[model samples]
Target: MEDLDVVAWIQVSDGRMLAVRSRGRDLLYLPGGKREPGEDDWSALSREVREELDLELDEATFRELGVVRAPAHDQPRHAHVRMACFTAAYRGAMAATGEVDEYRYVGRRERHLLAPAAQAALDLADRHGLLA
Candidate 1:
């Protein structure tokens, strides 16, 4: 059994949170990714958001949302994911780049469109009153 650790950005707007589909992937996920070796959560999330969304997160605006755990999507049955999540203000327009294929805002009714980890993040955001 392996645990896949990642850092995620939980950006919500107009009752929806930002989600993305990586190239060649079907499930939509939060705009973040796995942390690189020796990288802390802030740096990892910032780097991932920059790579996937083409924007830079403001360190000053960083806020801890919470962490979530779930079965790793599209991975082995025993694989699991532990996602450290946060919210932050960012600079520049957000557009799909790097591994990202499409980016959009999704609400609860659209939950089925996301990966397990992302679904967990969405629920966490809703609990924090960040979503409608």
Candidate 2:
């Protein structure tokens, strides 16, 4: 089986959590991406969030939320993804950039619209009282 190791930044406000849709993709995903070969969690997550959302994550403020695994989005059934998630303060307003085409804050009712990994993250956040 193939495994995709990636990082995600979990940003929730009010009752909604941040989600992004990549260009030409239908499902919304948590805001982060795959780590490069040599990058640690903070470095990789910060870079990915910056590239996708145009926000600078404060490395000093990062708090490890949790890790979640699920079948990989848009991949074969034998593939899976392991997402290392964190929450942190960020600088600047977030806007879609690069491969990101759109973004929205979604709640539990919208879980069906998210990719599997994102849905798992959402459930975890809700269980931890991170959601409204």
Candidate 3:
């Protein structure tokens, strides 16, 4: 089976978690992406957040929330995605960038709109009382 190892930023505010809808995509996803060659979790997550959300993640404040694995959304059954999630302070206003088309703050009630890995992250966050 093929596995996609990626990092994600989990930002929650006012009882809702940050999510993004990429261009040409139907489901919402957490704000992060695949690591580049030789990049570690912190660096990859920071870069992805900067590129996708136009925010600078404060690495010093980063905390590993949890890791979630699920079948790769829209991929073959043999494909899987392992998402390493982190939460941290950021330095700028959030805005859609790169391939992102829209941004939303979602709560448990909105889980059906999320991708598989994002849904897992949401469940974890809610179980840990991270979701307001």
Query: Highest TM-score among the candidates is held by which one?
Result: 1
Q: After TM-score superposition, what is the CA distance of residue 83 in candidate 1 from its true location, in Å?
A: 0.4
Model 1: CA > 4 A from native: none
lDDT of 3 by residue, 1-132 (tens): 778888999999997999999998889999998888999999999999999999999978999999999878865654889999999999998899999999999999999999999999998889879887
Candidate with the larger TM-score of 1 and 2: 1
As for candidate 2, its clashing pairs are: none
Sort every candidate by TM-score, greatest first: 1, 2, 3
Error of 2 at 8 (Å): 0.5
Give lDDT tens digits, candidate 1, residues 46-132.
999998998999999999999999989876644888999999999999899998999999999999999999999999999999998
Sorted by lDDT (best first), the order is: 1, 3, 2
Candidate 2 TM-score versus the reference: 0.95
- In the range 89-124, model 2's lDDT, one tens digit per residue, is 999988899999999999999999999999999988
Q: Which ten residues in a row are the worst by lDDT in model 1?
A: 73-82
Q: What are the candidates' C-alpha RMSDs?
A: 1.2, 1.2, 1.3
lDDT of model 3, residue 113: 96
TM-score of each: 0.96, 0.95, 0.95
Extract clashing residue pairs from model 3. Answer: none
